[model samples]
Target: MPMRRLRPRPALPSRRKAAATVVAAALVGGAFVGILSLTGTPHAPSARAAEGTGAGEHVRAKALPADAHGKSGKPGRPVRGVRPPVSVVQIVAHPDDDLFFMNPDVSQSLHSGNPLTGVYLTAGESDGVNARPRDAKAAAPDKAGYAEARQNGIRAAYAEMATGSRTSPWDRSAIPTKGGGWAELDTLRARPQIRLVWLQLREAGSVNGDRPYSLHGLWNGRIGVLASQRAAGTPVPTDFAYTKEQVVATLTGILERFRPTFVRMQDPSPGTYPKTGRFRDHQDHLYGARFVQSALARYAELPGHPHVGVQNYLGYPTSVLPHTLDPETADAKLRTVKTYAWLDGVHDCGTDAGCGDLKVAARPGGRGWTQTVRYARGTSTSWVQRDRDGGLHAFSVLDGRLAAWRKPADAVAWRGPELLPGGGLDSGVTSVTLPDGRIAVFGTRTTLGDSATDYRREVVTTVQDEPGGGFGPWLSLGTPEPDDASGTSDISAPAVTVAPDGLATVVLRDSRHRLTAREQRTDGDWDPWRPLGGTDVYGDPVAATDAEGRGYVFASTPKTVLAWAAQSPGEPLAGPAATGLPPTTLALSASAAPDGEGVRLWFRKPASGDLRSADFSGTGPVSPVTELPGTGVAGYGPVSGGDGLVAVRSRTGFLATAPHGRSGSRPVWTLEKFLFSGAPDAGTDGVAAIGLDARLHWTPAGR
Candidate 1:
């Protein structure tokens, strides 16, 4: 009777236009937002905060404002960011864009519990089929045994999301993809920090009007006729022909073997827009987002590449839109991938892949499934630190602009490329920080029109540190202006914290999707945006603050997965509940509790790909949630060293975690190895510090 308590929300709304159209229709319905939580709520228990009323002040006096400058009401100010160790890797392209576009940043870097690995890149064999559901001898079988039954249905869904028991059995191995051709690779192993590698290939073709092998004849600049296999021999075994630079050198040799920081693909933009019908997305998601942007520009000219982060998802018809799930932390990510039973066959769920070929087989008349959905990368990022000298930073934004990412070794006398001054980054730059030390960076910068709700505005770029330290060039808080027209405004991708008096609270998702909270008046300015309101969830809103500074924001909508409070100094927050997530979600990050608890949210469940957690307990709600193993394609893990740790650069090498207590959620250390071949510089002491692989390892925070 779960499915969110047999579907309760009898019309909830209210948390500011349901947080901008249900977290922008569950991020453009990717992973079909897990079939929009297949109707899940029966666990109850949540909903509390009401006595002398002060769970934090019932939505900050009505969503905050009065000049709202730095406290996120914004007038000016800015500043600085990790968790990482070794033994972890994740390289994605299909089989659940790493469970919803590299989810919860690959389930908060596998709960920092370490030892993880994943690399799929196609055997996502499309319709020729496999995640089961095809009867008549499996519909039309023999496409190389339905590509080995969709590689044993993603090895029983990554052995039931990394070892919960999917019967554990894969070890295949055929490898070699960049032109020499071969493809087969599969490995599952339940523990020792998990593992899954697939490699299949083939999918591509389809520009919208699918018919005669399309992706517009293999990425409009036609190269190997879109994943050649022409003669459609069925399920790529290759007659030994390749060349799209040998399939981008068999995906740049799986990115020089596990050199991933975050890379999730699909939606390469020309999904066919000419008349607009099929161009909304798909063509093996635009040749897998242009072959992972030409294998990350050849993994940044090889020689040790790994500080990479990319996510894109959204195909089919973006599922009519609106379902969102940050309902105060979507029931702690629905208790980390639970529900699936739904009364009968759920495909029997024994081997763990527990059936979810986009869902439907729950039995009793069935028909509820909606294309086994999985879309990701609608932009949701995290990274922090503003002062203290160690410098190291990044606040992220893509497709909407507002960037920042510093490190050239951060200190110990480092040297080069962290500079990126103003010039309006223009695309979706979700969030960035420096709240009090002074270099802020929030995102979303497109205005002119054409969907994304015609682009409203919520930018906020700042950088003014010099006097003896470093950064000084950028500035633009400019009066909450961002209205580009306001179709309810649509905002997420902004989360900054900084209190203890220095001011700065910033958390986002406005246009009334609520979760607002803008306060920065110690003289810095920003004051009018208020409303830590509640109800509605799905995220791209992450915030952190502890060591006494107070604040916390988290979010993730659709009806649960929450966190929002302030607790003191003029208070006004503390009312929002439920956090039992996991029915398929990806994107939500938080960390600021260095040793114990105050804030710690991170997600990713794409049905059972795993990686989940919860902690923030100022009164009740968020706790007891856990699940960790591996899966990441983008959410660009690693970058946050304000105290409690977080760092992830997967493909199976370099992981970090800290999470802490309430007795559930795990990961206090998991490192895999030389995590990032290039990008990584965490060290708020928990140390992640990477850049050019050379094989390093330190991984330990676990206990």
Candidate 2:
């Protein structure tokens, strides 16, 4: 599509002067209390009153009632008997964070005919210039005006995505937050189910610089309160501030009111560069997500809340990785960015702030951001396991608990995504079958203490007391890293293997990109964690057993794959052998070889989603690699299943499956329409995935 051009509207002298005064006062004392119209025209009270409920009700920040800070109610207490409907709430740091990191999924949710709410924590008023650096007519630093323009652009983009029209009208108003501040709420007139909320808090301004006024500083207690930067035309009549506790309370209150069934946020632990020790993502994206994490923890304790599933999206780091979307999906995503960037230069939104974010118009794709979307966690392929009796069991972390689903050996239907008792479980849960037929589930858990310094992520597990029975209490397997400050809690999800003698080993990649392991002794006690010796290891590790009863663990670096193996059934693992494998996309999965002699490793070619595999005997040179025949479909993430069937993500961000190992007959991939979380799991009986709607979806064998 070609960019459109339109005539610019003349600036109104009175409104322009008022905006300049507001900016000057803000710079003088680091506080802003003035209000100015961004559109050069005052909002009519009649128009606001006709929009929606509470549209014209404006409240001053100084007059909030004392009861506004009331508790979110008792923990684990249900006030309603019926479960709430499926609703999604995405909390992000800035306007485009969701568009850049969570799209395709965001668009799919909008199209699902369910309610979706987007909450932006920051004003995104970077440098306050609404034009490219080269633009001669770039506006001066007016933070409030710039923020308002970005909000306008986001509204246009969301309206077009939901109602197929960029000019869709919205009912804009102010809502008093549970945090003692007012947030701007906008609801699309055409689709009342879609909403956008702006917290209007000050942005960090720099990508990684240490700014004490930003969320990072507030989180670390370097600042007492983070002040708001109300947009020029926001319905919120006055500015306010939020303490760390107040921010969490606000989010918890939102959760209680909206009661969303799924939540999306940026990655709190995006890790750091191994060489420079710089953050891999914007500091706001990281620390802002930490606040969301805290809120979710508090909300989980409140009464009458629906079960929620969460997915974290990768931000700036995705630019360096392989693109995950196919051309068609990428193009669709780019169109939305163009709308938000105001690339067409059409001033149709009736705003003197220019309708969209002009600064983004210079480079709408955001340094390759528009072309890819990747999950920061929950991509493990070991989530499914077959029991000794031919039953299949799948596990996923939902609502801070273990959600288990099972299909009996003789039954045609899958039943019970029954959540096990306990909380604090993070995304991604892997399972392994014990020698006695019992199953053990492994995952990482986050603990949000009263202080920021107490935030931590640790490995935890629960196993069935007996085969096909209930699970025991969650057992903690302390993290190898000292704390969140030094490591940013960048540990990978646990990958486990159980030996023939009933000894189990759990392997994980730590913050320093090295492998660490904790083994289970024959007495049922765990050993202290120790380094396994691998460098630059990225992504989660995978473990599997061979026909000879030896266990192997594998992880990937940017260059090649690394392997460690146990010599015997219950021996210590040794060697970080260079497998001589070509560079992969850092996604790996393993299953028993059809010949019953060794284990087969599956991975994707870098930048090319074609499947590749090789057989490994755990302690020797690897076998020659073989490429699976292509079916014109390509996507990232670990591919599951062996010779009988395979499940993978298709180019369209949907689940797909095909028959494997059929000679002379090309595999035909059948695609599912829904988007799903984590990776797909396949067995001889069927394939399964956790849908984005937080439910289990199954495709039986031979369908």
Candidate 3:
């Protein structure tokens, strides 16, 4: 049945008339011509989405997000020199999952000096032997021995990332999680802050674990006690079995301990029970991630949990796609994987779990994953923030430097490739207009050492003292993981909300994936970084101001959307209670609800790549989630809004804009070839995209 939503609560009277006129004229040819007509400017063909395109090709509103010509509007090949600010904690099914599916990203994080922690769910004892194929004297299958070897390989690779030596010693210790399980923690002796936690659970051993001996069994209620398979040569002698509930609690305990701001997980949506085809990940990878998802959900409900962000990687699935990583990045990723594969001679760590997986060693270049990296939800996470004037500014990281471009409030021509006063800023950026009109840019910036092993990432900021004025020097807002010996931490792009009185609160996901914040006091001083308390928030933070000038913050977890709002401006923030939204893609766009009664949220339904939205009036329950008109590969990105206009991009790389409430499933203005940085700033002059060609693509306001 064709779903009928309440026609997006009709626009205001005069604007409604303008829309009616547009519809009347547009009905003659199609919504395309009608929308273009509203702009009252000649439309040009779009070719710069991915690969450059020629002009004169007609772009239309009714078309899907991607161009039929194969211009997918993917973000320009990622700028190579910059580092990611995201502190990453990858929880995977085996020792090499990070190398295989989460490459480049894993390597990039380490190389950029971001604090990283890897959690392995199982021993990965496929044949249970830790021997290279070329070694004729290799031992027979011994799960414990093989697990130890894998751990050795992982440690070597991680140590190299931290201190430039594969054989760097580690301080191995057993830590008890809140869920009543003991985990092996290996902290690098050279870099004590970076560590690996091994749970050493038994593997399912097959795609379908019908025997009830696997994570699948535990998740499906087929098994209550999943036993631990301890790795060899470990000082901790005891082993234990966990009930289904205990497993989730165990994972949750780890989350609480690590408190990752961003969690990298294998895709958990396997689509069907008897998994088939591309959408399915390994059963363990799928279910193990499901366990993590379960943990995140449970953790989020805790009163004082940190906001955790999540990013899911397409495992095995990435092997078939075109390479997403640049050659340099991919090659760097391969080297790290090769280390885990023990491509270099193995270090004889005396134990049952041998040096590393020989199968991967024999083919260390890797089947598919080592050569590329793909985010299940698509990447281009940069945002473009705007202010009250018609003028708009776009910010991005170019060659590790924060770059800015501004379209003057009164003119259409964009100007400035102006570099902000910092070189180590993270790739994507977040900006907020202060109450005084100064634009403040917030991001987790990285300081690259002379070598890949020397790096430090922290949340920092720089703001324009006045609109269109020069920006002050990059300012230190500080990092969440300040005292970690590694000196690097995972923090999400900032979500800074400015109140009418000019009070601003900066929200971020700490290394633990917990939501933390720092607010500006009336004395012009900022508060210390502190947890505001929410969990499993695996995406960028978003916020909007209510009529009362109170700020409301929202974040998405694997299961649902959670929100926290200030009872009043400058008051301690409260209530990250559930907002009643369903599972959503990590990306979200939000604005003040048109009715002034609540806030409206725009996001993609996970995996569906369909636009979805919901509204919550502070007085009542959230409105039902409604699907918007978008079905594509990338899902949705950041959104920009102002002066009653809102703009967004579908995952399929389409550009869309509409009057505040009027953009539901059907947006009023769409340009199919409009691929851009996720952040779109809308103002009286028009809607604009920081083009893939590194130019500003602007369309005049429809009304």
How well does candidate 1 match the true structure in TM-score terms?
0.30
Clashing residue pairs in all predictions, respectively, total: 170, 0, 34
- What TM-score would you give candidate 3 relative to the actual structure? 0.50
The regions of model 1 sitting more than 4 angstroms off are: 1-120, 124-135, 138-141, 145-179, 182-249, 253-298, 301-309, 314-437, 440-464, 467-494, 503-538, 542-554, 560-563, 570-703
* Model 3 lDDT, full chain set: 0.57
Rank the models by lDDT, top first.
2, 3, 1
lDDT of 1 by residue, 12-125 (tens): 111000011111112111011111101111122112201011001111111111111111111121111012223445555555444443333344445545555666655554
Worst 10 residues of 1 by lDDT: 12-21
The predicted structure with the larger lDDT, 1 or 2, is: 2
- How well is each residue in 149-243 modelled by candidate 3, as lDDT tens digits? 88888887787766787878888998886668788988877666587999888998776535578887777667778899898866556998887
lDDT of each: 0.40, 0.72, 0.57
lDDT of candidate 3 at residue 645, scale 0 to 100:
65
In candidate 3, where is summed lDDT lowest over 10 consecutive residues? Answer: 16-25
The local distance difference test score of model 1 is 0.40
Best by lDDT: 2
